[model samples]
Target: MKKHLLLLSAAAAALLAEEATLAPVSVVATGVEESVVEQPEAIAIKEKPEIELDQVVFQKDLFNSLPGVRIEQTGSVFGHMTAIRMPINTGPYYLFMQDGIPVQSSGFFNHNGLAYTTFGTAESVEVLKGAGTALYGSDAVAAVIDVHSTPAPSEKRTFLFKGTGGMYGYGSGLLEASGPAGEEGGYFANVHYLHSDGWRDHTQADRLEANGRYDLAIGDANALKIILNASKTEAQQADSFNDYANITDRSKAASDDPNYFKALEYVDVKRKFDYARLSLEWSNFSFENLDIVTTPYLRYNRNRYIATWQPNLPANDNELTTLGLLQRNTYQADWGRVIFGFDTEYTRSSLTYDQKFDIQTSGWSAAYYQAGTIYDYDVDYFAIAPYAHLEWNMSDKVVFSAGLRYDYNKFDYTNNLEDDSYYYALTSKGQKAIYYRPGDRTDSFNHVSPKASLSFMPDATTNLYIRYANGFRIPQASRLYSMKAGYETVTLDPETSDTYEIGLKKFFARHTFVDLAAYYMNIDDTITRYKNDNGDYYYANGGSSIHEGVEVGAGYAFNPSWRFKIAYAYGYHRYDNDPKYGDNEMAQAPNHTGNIRLFWTPWQFPGFELMAEYIYVGSWWFDDDHEAGKYKGYQLGNLKASYRYDDHLKLFAKIDNVTDNEYAVMARYAYGKTDYTPGDPALAYLGVEYRW
Candidate 1:
């Protein structure tokens, strides 16, 4: 292979680290300039590392060397899930943001959606690939993740604390504070705590999180801000959702009956989340051409579960509440730059599912006591979107853009049942069971999304582009009150997509850098969940799909400390015109995935640093008819280090799965065998931090 590509180009020659110099500026494709944007979609960023490590832990290390990201967890503590070139750990095609709004509360609280995000209270994390409905509308189809926090430091006044302990009895703590909350204002605060006893066996976990912020400087153009956050959790993952093929010790655990709950806090997993936000700003407002931003927000969530196969059923409650309004303005003429926005949201959801009575062993779910509440519901949702964006600059090597967004969604469902029966004894030994009544519904949908792009820099480190976008997704609320009231869940429709992209970026001679993107998507009406002819389970529109992908990334710097990075992604999904998964290849889709990283800092190292990583995942198909003993590839290896002394200490360490590779971070194929979820073996941790 050309001498392995010249020994991988002499091992990615020239690795830099002055915080990996150059290439670090994003405003998420244009929310109106915070500088450095060349946009054409497909952006991924994760900054904050230049020897600042306390050894953060998984959420997949916040995608180190980002590019076609990946995040999956189950070794313990917060089981996150994500995959970017589509499918593995999927859910409404991704879209979870925090500083750019949309943080859960999108069309019926997706299961495991963003798993109570906060990824350690962010401070940079932005990702966007193809199709984003010209500035977010609907579920943003293929990608969007924004989480930014940590800003409220201004020169003086500061304090931080950190703590850590390792080896299956792990512990963590963090506390922070930042200066002035007045007098030209500033403010920040954080609190975090976590506990684990995991590596397997009835895993144990605990968490508490907190956040507070305030900033003000209302003159000289105005400003004001406020934020608050809270979190709580208690976890235990008994061999994950049960059924692990006769269990040969894949971390033991297979539902310990816990004497069938009824107390002890419902005997297992519980979680809660809360958030509040407010902002007001001007900074120009009509005078210097215009600049305005406004925000009003509120969020809340709650979860409970205790019956991973109905072990006597009786705990399954979920709730959500949301409120929002976001407004924007940025207008700077010269026949170009313009942006206008309006987004409003309101959501309320509550669900309950609990039932258990009689029967003796039929197999998984139904064989014991009583626990009422068969099915209950409450849903209320409303959404609004209005947007516009533009960028011209047609010379100097062209640059053109356009965007438009319009979305309206409505739903109001109330089912507090007056009669319900949806029980199925071990899958059809009771001749199936499906019955329901308890109406009152209203649904709505509207969409209009568009976008265009063109860019060709030709100079200043290269650039090239082509793009088109449109996205949509709506129909959830658990696929609409679990259907049964005018089939097709009230005229199913909303699950749309249209994307086309091409990209290139370069920076070569300054210690290397490169990125590439390619995409094609067409999706429509795709909202699956089959089985009809009286086999129960419904929710239609199921058809059409075609997705293509290619993503690449590279980085090199062998200067102020060696560095190297690599990324790859490849996908080719099918199933166009589905009536039952035609052409297959779209369930857990993963044609290829990649990663590589190496960084060091020796050469009179002044603060020490090192990192090593390798990850790859390929081969997938867990259904949608591409079945054949189902596969689900895997690979991983990790190591990290950091040291700092004098400057208020900092020390870190990590070693994970370093060759302990046992695989199976996830897998499937039910009823006739095949199940896995064992991942996590060689582990280690160390930490310290202090600042002033």
Candidate 2:
């Protein structure tokens, strides 16, 4: 690892010596457009050109290139878990959006929520690290990611087609079209399909998605933009392998031991997801010195999957429908600016859990779960947030910003099943109730978050800033109502976090760009799963946790023909004042990670480009207990090349995991054994793109 870092540093130094110019860029994820060198936030962006150059097939492939960001693929198409300035986790810690519109309600956060968006059709993707600004509401604690759709072509009509095939029976096709309508309108539409016979057993998956956008000029100073997206995904979920030998084999579906069987049997275990959304944006309407933007959206999603990781194989079917609106008004003056906004959403959701058949095994883990309906419930969620932001330009060299937001969330939960204990069994101690159902209840919570930042610009191309922000996540309905052993009622507090960060952005000689940031976050009232002395599990509010990290990203455009880029981060995450795991390193949190890439467009060969990338992940503990020891991380190499054959045709090829190193994407200790999810092996892809 040290040698690789040294090599990357040397290459960067070499590239920095050359003279070149990289045009200035702007960031638009903060509800406003501002130059990168002037913004006080830690932001990273991937534009369409870069996405096309890499032929990105998954969201992880694009996000892993950003600093302090790590995404792990879970052996299924579009199944990913994200980590940003915190431990790798799946919950309501991060917010996912499409063109500034939340794709899913925060009350129903899902780990695979990104799949609901049409990533393949994005014109740009932006990520804001640490706690989000006051412009966003709940579930914006660790990070916020927004995907922007491709704009319609105004000059002429164009069509694009792309096809690819790779190892592991992977294949995909895409069709896109954009054109001008009349004189003041345009439209863009696209459809994508992908299929993969996953490397692991029983993990075959397929997805189909479509996106459409239209822009209409309402008048000289106002416009309307409409967006539509839909997708459907189907897969056979994979199970973790408990044995080291089976992990390496890559073919085994479960452990060889007869005592413990994998969740999925020879019979197919189906997992399906369906999503659809419609949103309209009306912007740039000015009244006096104020400009207003309004957006109204509706979305629906449904997911059906088997609980493969749980001891009891309960099949779950969940659905959510959301209607939301966003209104913003910005007032500008000579000395400063004031922005005020309000966000409101109404969601209706339902969930059902069923255990198809009783576990025949005598293992203690599955003894309490019987073959029956575990839970059936319906929930209606309502949330409203109002926020205000003030930016004061103190002087030519300094700027001060402050923001405040108030959020009100309410949930009306109704139990469809009998409000009583469903099953009971005898444990080592005594007879105990295995499952408990609670009666209908209504709960509400209110929270206030305040944020402040100061920016100092010593020169035209350099900025230094310090920012502090507060964020929170409302408890989900299931966590608030679902009951387990020894409990008839459950109450969980909302998770809250405070973050302090210092950052610097610099543009040197218009050729090199650098961004550096260090942040510390303290989270309170963390919701954690607790196990009693009787070995029954339940949800509770744990103490707290601390996460601190430093991230650096730099790009040196030596010339138009040669460019070098790198992103590196080092993070520390640990439990703080927790009874179960005091001061212990968090699970799935790596110490360091880095990505380096070199792009070359040879002058000797016309319309030809080549890219080489190196990726590294540092070691980390397998679990919070640290009983299973550490997992020595791995490194990978990838290469990509493209050639434009003509004005309308192009050919591209890529090889990933070029060294064919075997590794695990995820690992943990459970059931007195270490379980692993194997990563992808060496894969090769070739594709053709046509445009007219």
Candidate 3:
């Protein structure tokens, strides 16, 4: 078994070497543009052409082609749990941005926040692995993902329309238009609509998104850009089933399981989300050796969902509106440069939870709840951070960089319920479940993050770098205001991580590129909930953990017609000094993950291309206590082919799960029962495109 798994890793090829070196531009490392090789961080980039080839149906799959990154599908339509240089648990350990601006405020962090942003018109996707630099502050612990939108074209007019369909009642349409607006400006716009009556019994999904951008070339020294996006998504949430039959059949829900409690059925569980954002950016104004940029933005996001995973299936509604600004100035000289920047944001948010119906049951799966509103609160959040970055060229072959940031975060929380109110319920084990509401209060937190790196370019094709960075996540509104029995006064500190990494990059004969990195991260003051001696759960910042991993990405082009690529990562995550589960491996932190792909473009038949990919997910313990056994992960195969029939017409076909294997996208053990979220079976999609 071990040898077989090793072969799987070896067989998973990497991205094209050309893609790695061609058009190499990265902005995530610093707030400014820099080549990936010259940057001191480990970054992976997927260009627009590569994205168009994938014809991605689910946004969660957008970044899986990169090493050391995984987005687990959890049956919540566009929602996912991301793992990048950390455990696979859903925590506020990542920052998602659009065109260098944050999609959501850190005070209102959501693990499934990826759904709040649209990427239908993205020009490129960039991921900075491990801890982020000073340019990014809170919620930049594990990784930072930035999606850059396609800029308006300045030379010509373009229009495109595409339609896609597959089994399981899946269909989608995409329309895009771009052109020069006038002598000094241009505009780009796109709209996407998708629908699917999912393979599962109750997993239908629908989404609509519109994204647009306008650019104005102000004289010759400056430019003004405007960005706007909006999206709406609705989906039925599916429940994980424990029965093997349900998993293999791929047509069952929790309501169909005989062993499952009827009262716990989540057939009607669903979610609705709406998001909109508008931003204005003024950039490229240059004076003697100096450059400046300013961006101001407004964003709104609302979500209403049924908490089916929880007992009694309560309904949760939350919304937030944000006004934010980003300002930066850069001074450049012969010997590197200096950057000064500050970020400010103010947000108003509201949350409510209510149980529409009361249900009670007996036996080992016993549960009880009262039909009434439990939590209603409003929060106002304010944050400001000033940061500076310095770079020095020690020699022609080496560069050094350092940065620091200071952040001040404050939250004013108001509880609609009376102060010290309480709601009670029964747990699965027949114990009392207590929920508490605290009074209005103001809380503030402050932290400083520091980063430094040194890089040496031994030669034009070889580069080496080592760096240390610090990242943190302030307590979210719910963590601070949402209380439970025995935890009325939760004084949680910001969760912080310190990471050290070394990396090497080399190009072999200009046809192969290999990138490798190893990192160690230490997390302090991890936010968690623990049961007291009296059997009551309370939230606190009392946990610590250590994570270490090695990742490699390499690609080789045999010729212009054939290419092979491989990306693999091995990670180890464990508790450092926890009261429970000491030294145990973190739950769901897979030890191994890899991807391999082979691409062919026939020279004889121009515009015809084919690609085959193999993906592997390794085994891991299902629970933190290490008592429920391990879940041996699964592997999948996919094939894609495209034919450019002419300049204005093209066709493509994709086959997923080509082996028709039966496997689970997610599996875990809880309450002495095994639950499995089955992956989809073999499926195919066909699409066509017309461009002018």
lDDT of each: 0.67, 0.80, 0.81
> Can you write out model 1's per-residue Cα lDDT over 1-692, one digit (the tens) per residue?
01111111112212222222455566666565332336677787766562244265556677534777777765334656677766765467777776677767668645344556556656677788767745687767778877666554443577889888888898888988877654566667888888887776656777776777666655556556676666666676554433444233444453333442333344454333334444333233435767777777888777665544333444567777788878888777776777888888888888887654433333333334334665688888988888888888888778898889888989888888763334333333344333344466788888888898898987756678888888888776767666553353346788889899898887664346888889988878887766555434456887878888889988888786887878888887877869887767776677888888788878786788888888888878766665644565877888888878769888888888688766666676533334466667788988888988
TM agreement with the true structure for every prediction: 0.33, 0.93, 0.93
Which of 1 and 2 is the better model by lDDT?
2
* Cα RMSD (angstroms) for every candidate in the order listed: 23.4, 6.8, 7.0
Model 2 backbone overlap count: 0
C-alpha lDDT of residue 55 in model 1: 60
- In candidate 2, list every pair of residues with a backbone clash: none
| Candidate 2 local Cα displacement, residue 225, angstroms | 0.1
- TM-score: which is higher, 1 or 3? 3
Sorting all predicted structures by TM-score, with the top scorer first, yields: 3, 2, 1
- Model 3 over residues 158-277: C-alpha lDDT tens digits? 899999999889999999988777776777889999999987766799999888888776666777778998889999877777676876776656444342344335335788888999
* Highest-scoring model, lDDT: 3
